[model samples]
Each structure stands twice: as C-alpha cells, then as structure tokens.
Target: MAQLEQFTTPVDAVVSRMRALDAALPARDGVAVFNRVYLTVTEEVDRRVGTGGFPDPRTAITLDVLFAERYLTAVEADGPDRRPPACWRPLLQFRRHPGVRPLQFALAGINAHIGHDLALAVVDACRSLGCAPAELEDAYDRVGDLLVSLEERIREELMPGPDLLQIADPLTHLLGSWSLERARDAAWSAARALWALRGLPELTAEFTDRLDAAVGFAGRMLLTPLPD
Candidate 1:
C-alpha cells in the first residue's frame, strides 16, 4: 500500500478520531457510499458570499470561493482520485442520493482544489463520526446551508462589493474575468472566519487546524495576482 504520509493536510490527525463514527453506518456499496460523503461543501460559499452575505467581516464572495476551494484541496494531499465533474461539467460524475447531496457537494468542493484521492479520507472521517458516508452527506448539507447563509451575509457586509470574474478569466471561459477586488475581500473574510471557527468544539482539532491553515495560506495567495 502507498504511504499516507504523502498527504499534506492536517486531516491525518483527525482521521483516527473519526473512526468510531464510520463503524455505526449501515452497509452500502462503495461508490454510492462515497457520494454520500462529499458533495455540497463548496456550495456554502456560493450561498453565503455569492449574494453579498456578510458585512462586518466585509468579505468578497469571489475571493472567499477561491479560498474555500484551496481549503478543500489541503485535505487531499495524497489519496484516491474521486473528484466528480462540475455540475456544469463531468469527466466522470459521482452520484449520491438526495439525502446525501451535501456531503458529496463538500467533497466535490474540496477536490476542486486538490486531487480526488483525499476524498476517501473524508469518508473515513465521517465513519469516526458514527455516521455513514450518507449520514455525513446529510449532516454537511444542513450545516453548510445554515452556516454559509449567515457567513456570506456577514462576509459581504465586511468587504466592499465587487465582481471577481471581471479581473481574471475562468478555467472554462476565457472571456470571463475574475474580479481581483472580490478575490482579496473573499480571501480575507474566509481567513478570519476560519480563525474564529477554529475555536468551536464541534469540529475535531485536526479538521479545524487543517482548514484554518488552508484559509490563511489561500488568503495570502489572494494578495498576489494570479500569474499571467
């Protein structure tokens, strides 16, 4: 077997703790089970920042999305490649049931920044939580929906409003631009929010630190313009 040490995210520390959670889940097929675990995580930023969600924190939605994408990738340092195609596109789409959409979404979001391999680890973490990959999917969706709305609202209020695509082109669309201003604001807001979320007890320490560090790292990237 390949060594897991190659995986860079701090998630390794938390994976052990989540084992108990995984055991409680009922039997299910592997691929179906996997989808139940990763979707909808990326959508939180879309809901929260996309609409100019936050104010005091003053964040740029576009930038936050970028940061969020980076954070998702951190956990994937080395693992199986299971990233699903974008809702708009699909190299090979993973399908999850309606109840499991959130986890799958989150998984998709995380994989967006890194390789698909890390997604397997995410499933392992869910197992430790006493939830099947499916349950984690449900849990994450509910959590992402509620938190993202509030976070996005607060984030928009914190940062001045701007469009990100205007500044740089999208991977899929050359003509479309990503607004640099939005990227700066979103990255900053996400960093601060991550810093604050670090204090919460609901998440394991490993999960918190890995994501927190990722936010800071990505936020720093926002400082530099995307290389031409």
Candidate 2:
C-alpha cells in the first residue's frame, strides 16, 4: 500500500480543486466540505455493513445515505453540474491514504451528521406513518438488515485492504459508511415516501435533487482545504 504522504498534500489540493471547478469556491465551503466528508464517511459505513460484525451498522448507513442521496437529488433539481465528480474523488483518496488518520477522525463527525439527519427524517416520516417509539426501532432494524445484505456484495467486490485507501478512496469510504443508523433512517424515509400515498416505489425527483445538492456541497468542501 502506498503511504498517504505519497500523494500530494490533500489540504493544499483541496483549495486548487475547488477553485478549478468553481470560481465561487469560498462562499459556501463549509457545507461543501461537510457534504464531501459526509459522503466518504457514509461510503465507509456501507462497507463495514457487508464485511462487518457490528450488530447495528445498517440503520446509520442507510439513514445517512438517504439524507445525502435525497439532498443530492434536491440540488440537481435546483441547479446544473454544480459539482464535478472529478473534484470529489481525489479528496476522498487523500483521506483514505494508508498512513492518514485525520480523514478517519473526520469520518466520525460525518457519522454523527448522518445520524442526526436520519433521526430528523425518521421523526418526520414517523409522524406520517403514525409509528410508535417501539415500531420506529423496528423500522430501523428492517432497513439495517437490508444494508447488511448489500454490504455483503460490496465487501465481496472490495474488501478492506491496504491498497483500498490509495486506489479508490471515494468508493472505499462510501462502502464503509453504511451502518445501522443510516439504514434505519433510510428505511424510515422509504416508509414515509409510501405514506405520501403515491405508491411511489422509485427514486423521486426530490431525492435526486437532494443527492445532487449534497454532491455539490461535497465537491466544494473538497476544495476548501486547498490554497488559492
């Protein structure tokens, strides 16, 4: 595995990348950074779910995924190509560097955000579902289970390894982020969509919008750490 120091300094590059993609890089850099870091963090959660022994990884992974995905969906709906994919990938790779640990710490913060987002969305959906406290826990569990199954696929394709941090950091972080908290919130959101009475069983425009917005935010965040 390549040492993290092998790559160019990430913090410096973040500045350049953000500016390269968008001239207005500094205005909303925090949200941008938050989104990117959050995405990477969630990806990690997803991975852990599959190859993991953790008891409740599902809920967090799915919940965080949904919020982020939904946020992206919303952003796309509102704007166009706000964040290029190219910008986010390298930032993630830097974080996943074999020798680096700050990215891992940032991931914890990302998880916290995922949990918060999921809890809020779950509470919102629960009101519509009329789900009781006990039932809410059950709802979370169901999604958590599905996430674990999905993680099996991810792990099979890409198990955690030394090279993972170096080669495909974004994807690695993405897969790892799926956990019980995320999955639980996602399940709740899924249920809430049904409560809308549309019988809609597909990704809605709103979800897409949120997903895109989140991606934009992330892209910007990746650039925030760099120098102009």
Candidate 3:
C-alpha cells in the first residue's frame, strides 16, 4: 500500500546512507568505526520492522529514521563553518587522533547520539506522528533494547584484550565510567522533559542547549587520549 511505502522509504534511505558511509571511510577512521556499529543496528531494526519486533510498525519506523537522521545530519554538516550539535563536536574533532581507540570513538559517538540527539529525535518523531512522547515509549524502549544488546558485542569486538586492558589502565576506568543503559535512561527523562516544555519555546531552547553542552562535555572526556 502507498501509505506503508511512505512510511518505509525513509528507513530504507537512511540505512542506505549509513551503508555508503561504511564503504567510503577507512576501517580505522573514528566516524567509520561508529558507522559500522550503527549500520549493523539499523539493519537489524529494518529486518525486524514488520516481523513483530515492534508492537506498532509504523511508529517504530518513524522513530528509528528520525533517530538515525540526527547522526547522519551531523556527519553531513561537519566543517569549519558549520557546527554540528555540541554533543557531536568531540567525535568530529578527534576522529583522527592516533591515541584514541576505536572503542572510545564508538562510545563517544553513542554518548552523543543517545545523550543529546535521541531526546530531540523522540520529540521529532512525536511531532511527525502527531503523538506525544509517552506514546512513543514502547518504540523507544524497543530500540534502546536493541542498542543495549549490541553494546556488549561492540565491546567484545573492539575492546583491547584483557592482557592489554589491565586493572590500572586508564582506558578501563574510562570504559567503566560511561554506561549505555544510563545514557538511555537519561534520554527518556530528557525526552519527557522536552515534551513537557514544548509549549515554551525559550525554555525548550535553553534546556536543549544545556543538554547538548553537557553531553558534549561527557563525550570530550570519553575521547581523552591515552598513551599507547
């Protein structure tokens, strides 16, 4: 049906863009590192869209696409003249540091996307769907669960081996400090707050700006370069 196609096209298009990024960037590029992880998650979401993975397929597709576009837009808009969201600035600025590990890059990217972009994306999806944040909670949790499931696998694939990741290693401490579960939880709270403030444009803008800066600060800390 045309109505279904209308809802599905954006999801497919965003997945295509991510796949293209995966192909174009070198394996070691920090953005590329995050792209690979994101692409995998997006592909899984796509495959599960109509297969009962989502209680409401249409809402899932809308939220997923909106959530992914924020990151893709940051990638597209990065430059000296253009500022990506504050939360995204660190990863873009430090993408090529030799001392920063792939795991750091991936998590920093995750921090930015979930910490800042996700809350806004929920608002965006709610507006597009003519619903409220609470209405989208199911879809949000489903997507968050998918990310949580992939996170451990991400660590296993990208983390340095146990021998290198000693108890005293700074990387170990840094890794322990940030948790995806916490970020996802905070994002839900922020989304609720943003939705509540939607009627007050000035307050909404200020809260969003503060959220962006705070998330960016966390990302900068996550990207701290350690001696090799």
- Every model: Cα RMSD to truth: 19.2, 15.9, 1.5
TM-score of 1: 0.24
The candidate with the higher TM-score, 1 or 2, is 2
- Candidate 1's displacement at residue 73, Å, is 16
1-228: candidate 3 lDDT, tens digit per residue = 466577788988999999999889989999999999999999899888857688788899998999999999999999878889999989999999998999999999999999999999999999998999989999899999999999999988888877775522788788899999999999999999999999999999999999999999999999999887
In model 3, where is the ten-residue run with the lowest total lDDT?
Answer: 161-170
Cα lDDT of model 1 by residue, 1-228, tens digit: 122222212332233322332354332322223222322333443344335443311122222233333333433322365532221011113222322222222323322323222233333333334333343333333434454454344334322224544333322132122222333334334333444454575654554445434533432222222222
Q: What is the lDDT of residue 38 in candidate 2?
A: 40
Better of 1 and 2 by lDDT: 2
Residue 177 CA displacement from its true place in model 1, Å = 7.5
Winner of 2 and 3 under TM-score:
3
Model 1, residue 125: C-alpha shift (Å): 3.6
Q: Give the Cα lDDT of each candidate.
A: 0.32, 0.41, 0.92
Listed in order, each prediction's TM-score against the native is 0.24, 0.31, 0.96
Name the regions of candidate 3 deviating beyond 4 angstroms: 166-168
Q: Top model by TM-score, which number?
A: 3
Give the higher-lDDT candidate: 1 or 3: 3
Q: Tell me the deviation in Å of residue 113 in model 3.
A: 0.4
Per TM-score, what order, best first? 3, 2, 1
Candidate 2 vs. true structure, TM-score:
0.31
